[model samples]
Target chain A: MADIRSKIADIYSLEQLSLKKSWVHDRHPLVKLASTFLFIILVVSFDRYELARLAPFIFYPVILMALSETPWPIVLKRFALTLPFCLFAGISNVIFERKTAFILMGLNISVGVVSLFSIVFRAFLCVTAVLLLIAVTPMSRITAQLRRLHLPDIFVTLFEMLYRYIAVLLGEASTMYTAYMLRSTEFKGLQMRHMGSFAGQLLIRSYDRAERVYNAMKCRGYDSFAARGKKKRLSAADYLYLAATCLPLIALRIIDVRAAYSIVF
Target chain B: MIEIKNISVTYPDGTSAISDISLAIGDGESAALIGANGAGKTTLLLSIVGVLPAERGLISVDGIELGKKSLSEVRRRVGMVFQDPDDQLFMPLIYDDVAFGPRNLGLSEEAVEKRVDAALSSLGIAHLRDRSSLRLSGGEKRIAAIATVLAMEPTMMIFDEPTAFLDPKARRNLINLLRRLPHGKLIATHDLSFAEEVCPRAILLKNGRIFADGRTGELIRDDRLMDECGVEALR
Candidate 1:
């Protein structure tokens, strides 16, 4: 129960990081958002065996993390959570496509091995880019940018509410787990037999809570229209940041820096 | 003034929460709605904000009737602070939550900021303007929730169980804060001492019906009435 509560607390740790003042955090949210999206698209667009080319993309997250003063352990912890799924997704690649791509130190490296590494690296870069974006920009600014981009009001509202509701759902689950543990002695964890009812109760409680929250929003004049905050004009630094980040990503996507490196050397 | 004329509210399952409840809270008057658990205090508050429609009868806020057309106006006039501060403070930041109502009202960004700043400073939580509602202490969250309502510039305020989860000092702080607010207030709570301290009048409810409505001092001292309503009398 304590672990669950702490994990819920950790969910907002990035938002806390975003509150810090730094050059990376001060850039316009739209540019930060655009740059992150551009980085992900470029990183994912690489050929399955292009691990060498995908290597330099690591600088984006690392540089941003350093500039923004975001702690590495927090990002690494969240990044670690995505590792198993990425590995699971690419594991099959290691088994199939066994054609030898190249020879490493003493053995032949299979195409499958190269592709698996590519998948893991791509996952790392994409995940870290997103984490950095969220770590630098507040959720409200992101949602506001989404609204400015002409996204549907309901979609943006849900996007914002869903982020908050995750905490609420986890909170309800944590409380119920504590209650269950208190009542049922000699149980290491929730008994499998009680799992069904526990989940049912959680669902009922969360549903009731969501209804109350909706009513509260309605009382405050929430009528499906997303509330508008002050619009920020992108300063010269914002444009410079956008060009500095995105232009390279576009350049990398168009040019094979790995091939060019071999020629130059 | 806020008036409810013979209002009846029933749940979807036909559970009659409040039956023909009639009451009026005049402008600038603070009243306590005292009741036991399951005594329809929340139902009454919900109906006044037009969240739950009354099966019959009328609720009007400052001469404007609460109906489909007047709901926006009525909501503007009567700000309700829910029992759980979490329910009311949903925005990511306290400033955003406080600015939510005025922004929805189509106020200019500058005007919204002014209202939010005024509300936060009035509640003495100006330092928490940038903090997330999730990170606030219980007392701070309660006050921040009230600020969300205050930014709307309502003539009347409704609070449901305002002191549900506060420490002694926080409760005292809330009591003092409530006593100082100039808006007419209809606070639904079972805390007799709290009611006696903050309100001049008290309306006691028993099983969805009005059992007694009188001065807070006289009602809190009515041992029989307190006993009948299952609420502890102030000794």
Candidate 2:
């Protein structure tokens, strides 16, 4: 039913990144983003076979996610969406590989099983890191950070338009579905023949709203030249937090000399 | 020092939103364009502000042609307030929204701060300065919306339906609020009583053209013009 499909979309938006909470919530988005990226880069830098070493790094983001009060189920559901890549890269690593029996808990497991398991684990961590970065840091701040990092204005604008409109569009769709529900019984909503036209109407309405928003933005003099930055004078506390988190990470980066373990064996 | 020479706007669907609309307001005068809904009141304002970019018109703000070369200059001079306060007050807090315009024009922090405070105080919404714009009452939001534009210190102010959804008291308060503003303003509305009260001059916009322009009371007193333009005289 359209209701179910729409709820699914709402669920996607409701994860750690619902705009209602994300707009006013108190998570240090930039800090969480930095940590997420750092974890990914650190994990990727490890050899595929260095599962034992990578195990320790998992605690950092896991603890951060938990402490941040992010909804882990949504995070995991989003993480699940990345399985195709895992299936392709990971299962390929399994199916086309040489199988030599290895002992695990006194039972012999194939070499294919070991590599596949490692690939899935690696994929899971990668997906989770991406999800948490988005979840903790509302897309708006992330877009702002991208702008700060000199990303093209077009993509930044695109990101902004997408983030702002996804909620608005979902709301529009919900209204449409509600109207249908009130008018009909059973799965009488989204009649197969009318789905195309209904979706077309929804798109037109969303696009029209976007244009109106842009018009409204201009009327209120919303040129980019108006952006304000807090003279966020790095207080001693801010510096301390940055140093406490960043220095060790930089030191670790420098010390990651050989990556110690090799998967090419 | 604003001019509109033979402006006509037709939507892509081949409907004339506004046709042959030509009017001008002097430096120290307030003008109200009154018309019923769907009569191109907003479209005319949008044309003046260069938002819609009239298909055939020459709009000059303070005599600088509104084109690519002087867009920022012209836009900098013209401040606009939309119908809904929510659309205009896009910033998190009122101070930020009020400061938005001045900051964009690259005013110094001290200067912008001064403008923000002065504007908010002028609108008597200074106490709402630190509050989230979303949390403000509708009237407060509208005042903050106006304050955002007021802080810019523009040559002319345009209000697109300033009293679309306000109760009587709030509407009266806003009318009083507008009456107190010392700058030139153009209010587009269908509320004839509001027009007669807040504006000295009224322009009747019908099918996108200024069908009549005269003193507010005299203009509204013409029951034929009011009916023709779809504006009912409340008084």
Candidate 3:
């Protein structure tokens, strides 16, 4: 129950931060969205052995965080939630491919070790770029941008409703869990026998709630077609931000900065 | 004006929620639909806006019958407030929720903004325009929900259990707010005091039928009808 409450708090905290007014936050959502998408693609395009190349990508999130005035701890907390899968994949690479790639001082650096580091670094940069986009851009703006891009109205509305209702579903589940726990004694978790019924009940409740929500939307003149607010045009500063973000990432993808640094050494 | 003729709504399992009910509310008239749980207050309220499909009846708003072609137009003129504010408020922010109806109506951005502002200020919640809907207290959510409907500039407003889960102060404030609004209202509430204060007419429902319909003053004093509808008998 406490965990779910904190989860809700975490989501709201990010939402609160996105509401702050800053140069980065003020950039047109479409521009920020495109830049972040390009950033992820560039980060993941690197060769598996290019660990040093990904290090410079850290500057993107760092600069954006500094400009947006969003603290590091909040972004890192969300990043930590995504770390386990990357860690598992990287560890597998370390275990399988152990051929030595280089010799430094008295040590041999294996191919697997280099790839592992590169994988972890790529994960860090990619996740950070996505998080930075959300941390700076309000979700409503992003969905509006999606609609402007001619995405299917049904898909966009689904995306919006899913994001909006997640907190409500969590709250409902938490209340049900609390009620069940109160009726039981010394139970560390829900009994396996009760899991089926408990989950089924939650599903039924969610379905009923969705019906009511749809009716509410229908009552407000919402037809099956989606309607978005007026589009916000990109200002001169937004274009500058876009150029600053995309140009260097594309340049790094074309030229291996890591190999260049190694040659200098 | 709103009119219902011989309407009956049945569930898929063959249980009738609204059974052969007919009523009407003329221009600028307020009416209270009072009933106990399962007496079909919500079912009937939903039917007014063409949300619920009536198996055997016709509902017309301003002489436009409720059907596929007229549903959207009817919805634009008849705004409904659901029982749960969370359900009604699906947007991330209050401003968006309030602007939703007007935007759907194809209003210009400037007009939508103006209407949203007017609605929020009328509800005394202009300061909460940017606040997230999920974080609002119960009363604030209720007020925000009303604002969302009011922004549509509907000719008539329908609320299902408007005072559910409200504190005394919030309830009083809501009743006062409803009294001041110019649009006609058909409110379904168990709060007889709220009905007395805002609505001049009252309709009592029992077993999916209208048990009694009369002036609010005359109806509340009818001990037999009050008892039949499962509401408290006036002292």
Name the top lDDT candidate: 1
Q: Interface RMSD in Å per candidate, to 1 decimal?
A: 2.6, 6.1, 2.5
Best by TM-score: 3
Per-model chain B TM-scores are 0.99, 0.96, 0.97
Q: On residues B116-208, what C-alpha lDDT tens digit does candidate 3 reach at each position?
A: 999999889999998877668899999999999999988999999999999999998998899998888999998888888999999999989
Off by over 4 Å in 2: A1-39, A47-51, A58-145, A178-194, A220-247, A250-265, B91-99, B107-140
DockQ, in order, for the candidates?
0.53, 0.26, 0.59
| Maximum-DockQ candidate | 3
lDDT of 2: 0.72
User: Once model 2 is optimally superposed onto the true structure by TM-score, how far is the C-alpha of residue B79 displaced, in angstroms?
Assistant: 1.6
**Per-residue lDDT tens digits of candidate 3, residues A61-132?**
998999999899988888888789888888987789989999989799899989988887788888888788
Would you estimate the TM-scores of all the predictions? 0.90, 0.72, 0.91
Q: Which residue pairs of candidate 2 clash?
A: A225-B104, A226-B104, B18-B208
User: Model 2 Cα displacement at B11 (Å)?
Assistant: 3.1
